[model samples]
Target: MSTHETSAREEVDAIIAGAGGWRAEALATIRAVIISADPEIVEEIKWRKPSKPEGVATWTCRGNVCMADVLKKAVRLTFPRGARLDDPTGLFNARLDGSTVRAIDVFEGAQVDEGALRRLVLEAVAENRAG
Candidate 1:
């Protein structure tokens, strides 16, 4: 991995570590899936602020693949170009009305379809590359 990507991954790790309870667990699980889906995928932290220093976790390849945001009630994983991808499994449960972005909201105790999630990550990567 490149130096920037390495730094970004480390930042993301810190973000995950800083989270508590279900948020941290969900973020870690999603991070694993994103990384496992593509060896070359880059992880980054974005949208930092004073109140939320950790910001959001962004996974990318040729372009933005997805970003995982830890919310109060759920962990939302959003794809910037989700409208163009085929989500037959219906993993994307939120942001469906948007023109481009789509998201999957994982609440506490929710069981993520690992295989399907991985496939979605792969598909998102392909879409990014094509664009």
Candidate 2:
């Protein structure tokens, strides 16, 4: 892998490690789901700051597909172009009021629909490639 890709993955790993407990596990699972959805998806770390130096874990396919954040009680997966995508599975539980972005907040002990998530990732990638 390239140095940049290696660094990005490392950063994401550190973020997941820092999260600890179920949040960490959820983030790891989310990462796998995103990657498994598309082979060409690239991992990235963005929006670094003093409080969140590790940044956010982002996946891209031709363009930005989705991003994951470890919240206090949940792991949030946000799609930038979610409004345009068809979410028949109703996986999105947050940001429904927004016109652009949509998010899914996975709380502790909550069951995640891997199949639905994978389809969402595929749709996001397709959206990115279409533009």
Best by TM-score: 2
Error of 2 at 5 (Å): 0.6
Per residue, candidate 1 scores C-alpha lDDT tens digits across 1-131 of: 78988888888888788777888988898889889999878888888899877778898799889998878899999999988889898899999999999999999999888899999999988887777
**Residue runs of model 2 more than 4 Å from their true location after superposition:** none
Error of 1 at 5 (Å): 2.5
At residue 130, candidate 1 shows an lDDT of 77
In model 2, pairs of residues that clash are: none
**Superposed Cα deviation of residue 72, candidate 1 (Å):** 0.3
Q: Any idea how many clashes model 1 has?
A: 0
Which 10-residue span in candidate 2 carries the lowest summed lDDT?
47-56
The runs of at least 3 residues in candidate 1 whose Cα sits more than 4 Å from the true structure, single-residue gaps closed, are: none
Task: Give the CA lDDT, 0 to 100, for residue 12 in model 2.
Answer: 91
In order, candidate lDDTs are: 0.88, 0.93
Q: Tens-digit lDDT track for model 2 on 52-110?
A: 88888999999899999989889999999999989998999999999999999999998
Worst 10 residues of 1 by lDDT: 13-22
